[model samples]
Target: MAEAAEATAKTMLGEISQGHLECPICFCRYKDPKILDCLHTFCLNCLDGMLSKQQPSTGKITCPVCRKETPVPDAGLPGLLDCFFLSSLVDEINQQERSLETQQQATTSPTCDACEEGLEVVSRCIDCEENLCQLCKAAHVRYKRTKTHRVTPVEHPEQKEVPSADLSKTYSPKCQKHSNQEMYFYCETCKMMTCGICATIDHRSAEHQLSEITDAVRSYREEVNDVLKKFQKSKEEFKANEAAVDHARNRLKIMVTRACSAIQAKEEEDIAQIKNKSRILRDKVTEIGKKRDDEFDKVHTDNKKKMERAEEIETAVTDLMQQADDFELLNLKPKVMHNLEFQKNLQFERVKHGESFIGFKCQDVVRDKDLGEILHEEKWKLQSEFGKKGDWDGEFNCAAGIACFSNGDIAVNDINKKRLSVFTSTGHYKSMFDLNAPYGITVTSHDLLLAHCEDHVKVFDKSHQLISKFNLPLTGTDSTDQCFISPWSNNKTYTSGITVDKTNQVALVDKKTGVTSLHSLDGSLIRVIPNTKMVPIDIITNKKRCILSAMYDESELRCVDVTGKVNVTARLGQARPAGVCCDDTGDIYVTVHGNGLDKGVGEVLHFDPQGVFIGCVARAMHWPFGITFSPSGELVVADYYSVKIFHRV
Candidate 1:
């Protein structure tokens, strides 16, 4: 039992030494421990060293653990609150270690600090923090000044009871300047604990508002408790948010895995088809070559036979002319001439095969136009609609541009109302900020708002504070030519829409130049997309980094790569395409103003990433303009007068 108790004591001592007794900064046993307002404790000398390294003009020290700043008292580092509890703990730990060491050596208990003789201690004075022997204990009880000091019996080595510190006594820390006087008052102005002497000498002014330490502690505890409660709620919120983000991450990973598998399967299938086509093509070329070779052999044989007959006839005719009579020559002439004429008339079968036309016409496999597409089965339904035609706070007057924050909050640019209205994902109005005829708006990857106002883009922080503004590249149009272009306007000089990609690059459409251009966050021109012909109104980018632009005049939705290569173009027939957005799956949702039958009606069209029309998401709207997807994957549309939200089923 004694051995077990000793082992447990050693374990506990080790824990206390490692966890609480050591200073965080110096990583050693604390000497004159001080506690910051953030509740982190460090040695006084360590704090002084840290303060000396900081800018003295700040007059504040930062906690090493939490980085919370606390004002340096006028008395400096020594004036900081002393951690009495921790100091007592350290003292107790030291005493326990000494006791354990002596027990392991089989020596007597610790000697009494009061007596000159080397005597084993029997008791400890909690107030004086000293060990005492039997004689010293009796003297301590009899002495008038020390009799009131609380004393506890110290466990001897032979005793079965484990040694423990006397932690029940209340510790009153003394003032650093006035070492003898206990600090019992708190100065409101200085925000530091002080003794009676220091309060009278330094904090006696009316502004100081000196109060009992107990009262001050109670008020501070209540305030801290209130903040702690709020923090607890915030922690819960953060936990939920973290869980949601993790779930999304897992889902995305699973989707990526499945997509990889599908792509591999498709690749194998395409390779097999290509190989089969190659084999067939090779066999056809071989068959044509064999037929041509046979025809050439037959022609060569026939030509050789004709050449031998001509040579025999030539020798016979020459002999007849030289040696035979005229009559004999005449008899052979008719037959020889007939044979020559027949030979001359004979046409050896010409090889029918033309010059070798059996070669492969290689197509660009990298940018295969017929490469398969991803099928999106999303079915969207109208979830809710908010706002009406008015100048009220939540109301909208010509809702033009729409963008969503990372938290699913929606911001709409009401051009006619001259305000930027914000709403929750569920269509609940939150707040609105005034702006000057804002047309196109986009939320950057950092959640900064960039609103197009006339010739420049105004940048605002999350709090709606104006950070900075930059002018868009001059379109060579003067101020007189600069006119406000509505979503339905066919104005060529209008700066129609803006979007931010994953790289935080701003892409905008300039109808005047009939081109789409990319810009930096500060509105500096990066590069204009070459070969963009159709007049674009609204633009958005997908996860594939392909820019999707809505050509209002041409009634087409064109998908262009970042390098200005047109990938796909979906013709909307008579309907005019306006605002465009892409979902997480890279599927597109375009808002069009007319359905070929009714010019006043509007509908949201859904398309796959390859620009193939899937189906109509929603219809029978009054001129839908700007469209975007919320963080929750809900489709948000800014119609003529109100904002409509749709959910993917």
Candidate 2:
């Protein structure tokens, strides 16, 4: 008990302790490591890792060393979580080895590389003892049953893996928590085993099933030791690799010096030969060749001469000896050589890109700039914020104007049905809310959504949570009895518009006069933005910026910016443009009904900032009505009959 406590304390102190492990079974790290409830751990298969393959009963998993029977679990044994105890045990062994090494260092003769003392290599056994020369080895092997006896060659003390026998002397170990009770059997009923005395008194009538713990623990121990040993070896290597960069740098410099010396020597030799040829031709040009040929040869030869001279100077400056003092020496060498060759050749064409033996020139580089969103980041592919909708394979009746929530949910206004259903980004109908004649919808900073119904505007929080609704104040027009009444009256053609204000209040166009009425976020009607130019169709705001709806041609598609200034008025005309939206980059998109001009389905058009008519983005909508941009700016179109996402091409 004293020894166990001491071992535990020593192990606790040496978190960085080291040692190697070997499996008493297969001796490999070949199985998943696991620890049992017993704190005793091992490889799940290590027990079966030693099972006699052909025997059906090997599944019983008997211990290799003790032959105690261990019952396997019904679902098969579990793999290891890590052999914590084995690692601790290995650490104990390492500590002993370290102490042994310290002792050996003190005793060994410093001068003796081959022996502890200068005394003649003397061995009576001629086996493990030193100095057993060839003749002695023959005599040692001649003994019966001792042929090839373990003999140390007389040069050094034996270095071999020695299984620790001192483990009992120094390794004070702990019993596994579950096994501390001297596990004779495991009880299946109460999941607790009774001692031999208690087993008969309480569990004798088969209320419990029992398996021997000795075999199970032993088999597991072997597997645990194997994994711990492998991990320890890998950890040792990892620690040694801390100097990886320094090691790479030193190796690279050595290679560079060798390569440069070989290349420079070759270059110098070629230059010298060319110079000699050029001098010969210069001295006897008339006799050397035809005049034209002679002139060309002279030029080529002269250039080679110049290159050679430059190389000699370069070789002197970039000598390998300089590599030690200057880290940038390698970087400069390539540049110097390139400049010398460029000067010698006189033209880049003659400079060597390949086969001509010339060097390289590193031209300056410039990064390409992004044009804009429509041309740059195609968000549909990059963003995970939006995904497909459900029942997307068939036509989706999107009457309740569709708006995309920032969290990838969609609020579709089911106009005739008066049902505002919240669909998941995947088109899965999550929940629904009731609204009368809901038409247009937009999201807000407070997680609330602004929606337009018939005569009143409804506000909903992110999860279809109700905030409040606003009813239009009465304003008589046309005649006394025929004049539009409040909320639900004549001339009350609320064209589905909702806008937000500086105080985070929401506003909407009265749809009758194009007057912009602002309201508190809590749905209290504040007032109208008097003198609005056109009747409003839809409203959108993102707190920092706001968009007011108005007529652009026959379609209601004029976009307003943060300062209540008009930025872009869309230029798409088809059946009758109904809904419009602008991305962060101020590009406008509008949905229109089926046009007689194209004789096709309704379509969506895109326009650049300058109102330069970009082009039609998407087609084939039965009656594409309300359009909105996702937070990421992908075009979300609620086709009066179906909803689809389109990229601004």
Candidate 3:
């Protein structure tokens, strides 16, 4: 019981000592405790770093815990007073350590060597380090030669004394290589600890740069300070990283929440539309059934009237046969025969068309479009290729324009080859037609094809035969015969992109001067928008009739309305913006050159109608120049070598 009580008391004291020894800043035993104005204790070096990070304009330090502001003193953070309470606690702990050591030695105290009988000792002689009892302590001091031997109590024990010149003999550990010799030298060149003999032999070379063993102690202390600084910096970095990760996690959760809400809203709208359509069809069916029921009721009334008339004729014949003459009977027979023939004719006419009047035809109606609704199965995948550079009868050299028809056909124009090649939706070579210099192609109507040539747009039917040729009108002029050239040079002019709007108006860009011109398909100029601020390369239109053009100089896409007015423009963050096409859902796919993994290669990137980034559709192509969406929403890209297609998965 007494031992357990002692153990409990020791454990309580240890906890109390740990609490008093801790520094508030590092939460560890204090290195050099300092007191702040708020009486809060922290490590002096930790406080120094905290004060350094504060803005100089404040001229005051805010405590990290309590946020209490204190004016900066003339000597800065180092001027804070030392913590005397912590210092007293440290001293008490050291004294307790000494007492514990004394108690441990008491168990192993030697018996007095000079005593008559072996007895445990309580005093020691410092000169000889020998234990003695109280009675022997007096005699030991009374001895003439031993009186000046500096006798002390045996309760306290520490290191043994040695000669000053042979201080290496008192080393805590002897050398590993030479057990008899203490390691007293440090080799600066080898960066190792060595004994005196090894230093003179193995590291005896002049370039070895041997030094005193204490030199390493000084360098190690400096290295310890550097390590402490690094530890502090690492802690701060971890805190910052934790904060950034939490922020990103919260942002993603919010974005997902918003997307889910939008999806649910679209679902509700589609349900409402379906319900409305169902209600309308139900009412129409009821109304048609009532109208046909009324017609059958009229036929039933006519049959009832005929039955009454036949009964009247039978009663008259009975009356005439019983009392009247032959003349009266003959007259009744003629009327009855006429009535029977009329009833027979009516029955034949109504029964012949009974199938038509008996029931109403019900036809199924389908909704036309989905208003920007996202479907679960709408994913992208790659499809087949058509015209290659060396393929038989279907060769295209440096193709740069692509367009898709409603009949699931794809048309591409090769500027170098000067031909417009047609392909099936799944990328089968159909046919090709030659032109002067085809730059861009688009299906203007169901059967009409518009191809922008060197100086004019040539219209063609499905058979690749030229139907009409409309030369691009000169800017600020209306004459079809006159051609406009960039003021920079007459012969260096080129048009790279063309798009037809809902009004059969052709929008084309002059690549050299960045001017876009709108013209009618009948070779008439409407209006010109000058200084588009980007080198317009490819153009497309949204359902709202807004023209979106891909720019080459800054790798940006710009929007213009049908009135030839520029609206919003944004950079796509690619090395080169080559071609752009928007699907029915306002999702745009753009081809950018030099953004692929290999040099001079390219990729196709997707974006929304509002210019928000979606994702990448296809990647790592050999310079994809033009892009378009097939009727089924598959992306058709004009690679330099061949055509590439991506289908909705």
Candidate 4:
């Protein structure tokens, strides 16, 4: 019974020891322990094994329990000292174990596990893990094999409290490769731990930077802290850049919304005015028709009365001649004659020929010069004029096309001179350069210009140097690089009026064939826009994804949408449109060449989007060809030998 009871006591004590003193990794008694940033304790050898296994992938020590990353310190894992509190607790547990063994041996009845001897215990042999009486102890010492074993007296007269021991400092780890040797050093070059035997054999080379495991651990801690600070700073910078980009995006949205609202309001006002004018003209026509109908009815009634009197007199004369004799007929002759004379003298009212009787007059219904007054074009005052017949810049010499740059500079294509002339926004000539029969010029970018020349498109830089050229294509050609000129017409090349769109596509028209073509930036023809019935002279684009072509031969403008479909064809009765442009409000402006060089006069005409003639915006010039608007919506025109600028008052 005593033996069973003693066994029970020892089992309870061992369970308590394992709970406080064992290393979690190896499930053994604690060895050279260290603490991590998360406050968890691990054996020194265990830390080295974990870092070696994970460092290649993570480049840092990852806590096994919490999965927190810690940068490996330069001094390495062993430089971290054993945890003081945990070490002290382990020491206390060891003391308790020894004290419990002594108490079991001192009891009146006890048995030794090693010798299986029943005795009254007098001493305990720690090495043999057995209890011994006086006789057994003497025998234990006399035995040659057991003499070196340590024995302790079981009886102590005074009772003393056992202090807690630190298990972290008490443990020593054995090498897995060489189980008999303890791991004592670390190889920095190989990032591995080694025992004393391994240090002399495997790690003996000069290339292996051997270090005391503890020293390397201290260096690792310092590096970890430094890297953590850098990571935090980078995260803050990324957040600030994101906030700035979001702010700019929101501001742009607001700007677009306000601009669209103002444009829509102006559109509504112009439409209302057009409707009111139509109503007035319709009412005037109705009143004239009603008055003419009343006057015609009165004339019809008077003619009917005279005809009835004549018919009555003819019937009475017939009855007198048949019934009465010669005497009766002669007596009725005078009366009949008087009646006939009355009928003969009766006349229908003569219609007035000088005034409009029933039809509406064109002058009353359509406003030509008078439309400018309604739109308040008088407020659009002239800013300046240059490039005139007598100007020092020299006459334009048949300028055919004009374009405005983003920076407010102006470029003109002088077909007669075969050169391009550039001027400031205020009409001061900047420079001129030779181009082969330049017909159209447009700014593809701030520094690049695309010019339509005789049979090819030429690209030029801001310095007026020709950079590249490509021939315009025609049908039955293998590529867009075909160049051909018909013998019948010298100017019947593949290109005429040209413009660049927001998408960087070049749109040009064939003047002789009336076929419009869209080309890629690299001079490859994408597709041909269907030809319109009227002859296309000049082309301009609006923000509505539509292009307007001025028909030189017809008194009309052709509107082509982005899909290459004709949207509308409208006529402005008198003006012969040579060049066309549009403002932000979709209001079109055209330069008129009324009767050619002999009698033709230059006039800038304005019209609404629907082709209702708004009026002549400008008049009384030699002849105007190309018309455009500045960024501020000011009118700019190439008047044959002059360039003119006009602005709103």
TM-score to native of every candidate shown: 0.41, 0.35, 0.40, 0.40
Clashes of 3: 2
Cα error, residue 320 of model 2, in Å, equals 76
Give the winner by TM-score: 1 or 3.
1
Error of 3 at 96 (Å): 88
**Top of the candidates by TM-score:** 1
Question: Which stretches of model 2 miss by more than 4 angstroms?
Answer: 1-400, 473-494, 501-503, 525-527, 541-546, 550-553, 559-575, 594-600, 647-649
Q: Whole-model lDDT, candidate 2?
A: 0.47
Candidate 4 per-residue lDDT, tens place, 506-619, comes to 877654455567887778998777644333567887656577887765667888975667765777566667788886556678887665444347788866555545566777
Best model per lDDT: 1
Query: Candidate 2, residues 1-649: lDDT per residue as tens digits?
Result: 5346446545743543322255545554324444332222345566555544636755565545434345555666553234443444465556665655554554443231234445443343445444544455566678776666675543445433324423323222222543444435545455443456555666677657655544433433354345345434543433323222222233233323333343344334453434443333233322322332334344445545544444443443333222212212221223323333433333211211111111111222223321111111112221222222333322243452667776877777655445666766666667776666543666675657777664677677656766677776553232222211213233323255665543577666655545556667665666545445455445554323556353523554555553456655544444456676665544456666554434247777654433445556776655556777666445776655555666323
Query: Between prediction 1 and prediction 4, which has the larger TM-score?
Result: 1
Over 4 Å off in model 1, which ranges? 1-377, 475-495, 595-600
Model 4 compared with the native: what TM-score?
A: 0.40
Q: Where is model 3 more than 4 Å wrong at Cα?
A: 1-378, 476-495, 530-534, 563-565, 595-600
Model 3 whole-model lDDT (C-alpha atoms): 0.60
**C-alpha RMSD values across all candidates:** 40.1, 34.3, 40.4, 42.6
Question: How much is the lDDT of residue 79 in candidate 2?
Answer: 30
Please, what's the RMSD in Å of model 3?
40.4
Candidate 3 has which clashing residue pairs, if any?
124-154, 379-649
Q: Answer with 3 or 4, whichever has the higher lDDT.
A: 4
Q: To one decimal, what is the Cα RMSD in angstroms of model 2 from the true structure? A: 34.3
